[model samples]
Target: MTEDAATIPIRPAELAAFLAARMCHDFISPASAIVSGLDLLEDPTAQDMREDAMGLIAASARKLADLLAFSRVAFGASASAETFDARELEKLARGVFGHMRAELDWQVEPAGVNKPAARTLLNLAQMAGAALPTGGSARVRAVEEAASIAIAVEATGPRARLRPEVLAGLRGEGPGEGLHGHWVQARYVNLFVGDAGGRVFADVAEERVTLAATIPA
Candidate 1:
């Protein structure tokens, strides 16, 4: 992450770097949990522990599957007609947040977004999901506006706060010293907004946080 006051577009190399980091970060936890479960299964004297290990493996595998599906659509590149089905995006978000403490309340008018804007919209929602670390609600909204589409995520819960570095990264000022691959989502949100000739903002209250980005119609 850079120290600039203005956000900049991420080049291919940078995007690749971020993707690599995030894939590892998102996949590692559940993957490790699965391995631990396997190890428990290997203990010859732990016959009675089979049921618990099986449950752990099943849950972790499901979480990994959910995350992978969401990431595939959110980060992959493809084209279909001229718009993205909002319902599909909503489903992906639900799948992702369902495995966590957050529940997504989604509202999308017109039922689709211009294909180019979908990624940013989804990324903002994902950011909102990550902000609610203490079991809260994250609302994702996409609405048609004056010559533009506005996407926002409003999250409320106890001890809700955007990590300072992540906030900075989303603001386009880079993550200061912590700019790494895991922060690419925030970076991409800002980058997409700039590419769409729009602005991004975030607000934090005592127990709430909202992150938003816009794209032109």
Candidate 2:
């Protein structure tokens, strides 16, 4: 796809707002669950349900923690670490997938990768998971090819589908009449991959969605 061809521009401020909203959306559910569990603990009448409340608190805490760790590397600067270990990346990917309906299958060839590649892998993997709402498999693969690192994620299962806004974002275009949360992620991926002098691609078919990118190594 041509970069920014026939694309509506999203200002920096708008992009930041959309990203912040997206992250907050992901975090709120677990956070709210934790709060609700605390409320139940303080209620004397609810003492009999303490066990259920505790379970909710524990699970919500874990989910929140997992999302936080994943978000750091996937979206934040991650404390100036330029390269990331594949195993650690896999752990992060699996952590997020643990709360999802889909399963993660990571098969990365490289031992480590730079920040852009790391973000690409994590984002694409999560996107793949999102594509399979009913439950499916998201297979992530990365390999060193010549002077570039190739990353691909194939999401396949019953009812798997790609959103139109995601396709637009992957093509470096703004989301038109679509949900900004989903759109911003693909747009962010497109921007970073392009900044690294690479290209991004996406394809959607019956029960399958594929996302791929190539970044300079």
Candidate 3:
């Protein structure tokens, strides 16, 4: 690591707490939408608006489900080594990013990946999705090794802000007391990777930030 990298300042915990609260806040809207849709279904007039209401309800439910599942792996209270299909991961990633306006250029190979590793990779994808504001493509890949798996996330588009804490998280650093949204994400990723006995590497170049992880099989 360069001196610049080593000297990267840590943010206050209050900031991290605030960022985490903000991220959770965003999910409340979708949960509320689901509730509204359910209430509409109970109304007699809803029969006429049934289709629209149902659509809203289904969309909200799916979004909530995706978010929850992603959170379970990204920010949840448990981390275990299990096996999951790569196709399922791709589907999950697509669903997570589908609501966004960005166009993700995702390519996932067919393979069975350890759950801990999968969760780590998913978190990275979520981070990438947040970075590309003007819309861009993110490439995700997993390579199975004899004793471990290597997962990589590469995103390219109009340059996006790459927070130092985000990079630190990938490099196995804790949240370090910052409340920035990105910092919270970094902490989440760091915890997930650590629980899985993995290491995260980040390469932030001129126009892109590439994150990769090596997880024990």
TM-score between model 3 and native: 0.72
Which consecutive 10 residues in model 2 have the weakest lDDT in total? 1-10
Candidate 1 Cα outliers beyond 4 Å, as residue runs: 1-11, 78-82, 179-182
- Give the Å shift of residue 182 in candidate 3: 2.4
In model 2, the Cα lDDT at residue 100 comes to: 96
Per model, how many backbone clashes are there?
0, 0, 8
* Decoy 2 TM-score against native: 0.96
Give every collision pair in model 2: none
Best by lDDT: 2
lDDT of 1 by residue, 1-217 (tens): 5545435555779777877788789899999999999999999988799999999999999999988887776776343546778888888888888787877888877577885577776777778878888778888787889989887789899878788777877777656666565366777667667876888889999889998777887
Residue 209 CA error for candidate 1 (Å)? 1.1
Candidate 2's C-alpha runs over 4 A off are: 1-6
- Badly placed stretches (over 4 Å) of model 3 are 1-23, 34-58, 77-81, 172-178
TM-score, per-candidate, Cα-based: 0.87, 0.96, 0.72
The deviation in Å at residue 184 for candidate 1 is 2.4
lDDT of 3 by residue, 1-217 (tens): 3545334544557545655696687689799998898888899966888888899999998888887766665554235536766777777777789876556665655476766777776778877777677777777777777788888888777875467767766564544554356666666666567777787877887668788888888
For 1-217, candidate 2 gives per-residue lDDT tens digits of 5665337677889888999999999999999999999999999999999999999999999999999999999999598899999999999999999999999999999999999999999999999999999999999999999999999999999999989899999998878788888999999999889988999999999999999999999
Clashing pairs in 1: none
